[model samples]
Target: MRIFALPLVVLASFVASAAAEYSCAGPDARTQPPTGAIVVDPTGAYSGSFHNLSEAVSNVPNTTDEHTIFLFPGVYREQVLISRLNGPLVLQGYTCNTKLYAANEVTISHAKAQRDISPEITSGRNDLTSTLRLKTNDVKVYNLNVANTAGRFLENGQAVATIIEGNNYGFYACNFTSHQDTVYANKGRELFA
Candidate 1:
């Protein structure tokens, strides 16, 4: 009888993967807002914090410096549009467990549909029906919940949780809650986990 030997690389790869722990924001979630970041705290617990996410996003300078936005615990009712920025953007939400999206303390919600055209949108657009719209590249969002409350209706049509028209987007430990079309992305590089 002949004995066959397995490759050493195969065994090493198995051991490395077995020891690896799956986590979006590492093992522990963020408790404190990062320095120099625009913080959004609707509860007013943090001094100088913006009351809403839209205001905080607008406050970001259009410079090629790395920027981060930390969100405190609260439900924010707004339609946010993150446009082109010169720098990389990071949106981090407060969470006790970074491993789970359900542990997120911050949620951005809006009830809108393509059928409902506004002044900004003269015609019905699939992208406009999204609760959160990202049109820029090099963006990473973590531990946040985005929801579209628009349900099944003949007039309401399909509702989207998020629309990513940007080139590069990475969403980690995030929850996109919607009955129809949870996410719609253009022809770009995107990742969701």
Candidate 2:
């Protein structure tokens, strides 16, 4: 058997490109929007504009306006995708302790995979089958938990917690839990700080 040695230049380029996808930052450096930002309180405590996350996202104009979605303490069992916002967007979770991902109180969860659903049903995009999918650039998610309960050992395959396919995306103090493809950040330059 002959050993094929990879070129040093190619190895260095791969390492550099991979390093560009990550960053290190303190919890204080996380994006902290104002309290007056658009709130999504399921208990009707904060007088939110919409009770559902999808509705709140849909209400935002797809223009160059900076928008933020503050999710109060709730277990949102829905599939959310942010695809057509032409501006910077922020999704922040309500947490008693913002310094750590463990204190996150908002959970956006779902259970679906390509093995269980037909390709046509998923619009031929298996990436969209995630619980949370972001297809727009300049997006930030902070202090939230995104989960896919579908077990990898089960017959269903390829369950994804969240899919980040956009550029300039940052996830700070966020917990993404799943058996497989917990956080699919395969497409763009992402920062999981």
Candidate 3:
């Protein structure tokens, strides 16, 4: 009986240590401004004047709490990756046509090289890669167009617009238009159009 009890105690200690490593930046501990009216703009006064979408996401709080990151009108030229830890995040553009452009040409040929190749590929013209990669659950995006302008002149490479890798994500009034992999929704459950 004593030996069995000792093993149980050791198992409990291990479980506690593992749980501590899983830190979710809970709803109550938001480091950024609340989601109600957070905005990102080059001319605005905020924690950081983000010149691109990636900078905006970097400032967002990673937690289960719901928060919104509003982007102003501008052409954001960069690859944006939204992490899985930031669930219930929202990225909204001020206008319907606000655009996020990708610098890298997304191509099955090129993507394969990186081992991050997208599943869908089109005629060297319409590869489905967009400029944005979303990996969080329950995220919402609205009124923005994600595009890859790399192959526009060369007509070889493609662009991946948006990659959704989490569950319960939603996109409303958002336009994902790219020459290649437009939107990559991977293993996500209950994604709203």
Candidate 4:
């Protein structure tokens, strides 16, 4: 019995390519922004002017539909505040390895602490230094890093990397770094996957 080998070879090559792209699937997945997501890129590589996390988070419309904000590779030096959303929100960072936090390329950082915050903050002093504050529920964050650049207990105090005040929050392959008080999820059911 003579079996044609060309079909088998082509199938093998197709499977090999698909397996190799498992880490970063989808067309132009590593280079293009995700569809239906608000893109944030500091280099102005995206179509919109949502160059900063602060700008993108604030502009999210209050709707019942699921929304997502995609961040490109960069260190965004600003505070990110996610207000109460009527629906679910997703904050995703561009990463080659979506399952590893160490490979995250998007970082939201701020060099401030409780002492640096003004009296205008009404969420109590504990939240004054948080670089990223999520006040809404049903949020998913992936492959992102948040850092409070305040010095350790010596010169700075209570520099929080993130503060989540909402329920049903999922943070996957994300890193929160700071000198003190890295993350505060006092009033929420959070999952760190």
Return the top candidate by lDDT: 1
Better of 2 and 3 by TM-score: 2
Tens digits of lDDT, candidate 2, 112-135: 876767656645345756899888
Per-residue lDDT of model 4, residues 23-141, tens digit only: 46554244456678888989896778588988888888888999888899999998878889999998888887777788688999988877786768756776767899889999999
Global lDDT of each model?
0.86, 0.77, 0.57, 0.84
| Count of backbone collisions in candidate 3 | 15
Clashing pairs in 4: none
For model 4, the stretches where C-alpha displacement exceeds 4 angstroms are 1-31, 118-123
Cα-lDDT of candidate 3 = 0.57
- On a 0 to 100 scale, what is the lDDT of residue 134 in model 1? 93
Clashes counted in candidate 1 amount to 0
Per-model TM-score versus the true fold? 0.81, 0.77, 0.58, 0.81
The clash count of every prediction, one per candidate, is 0, 0, 15, 0
**Cα lDDT tens digits for candidate 3, 1-193:** 9999999999999998877643323432223334464566655656655656677677777666777877666566666777766547777666412232221111111121112344453332222344677667787766566665555423544455666777887765566665555566765764444
Error of 4 at 119 (Å): 8.0
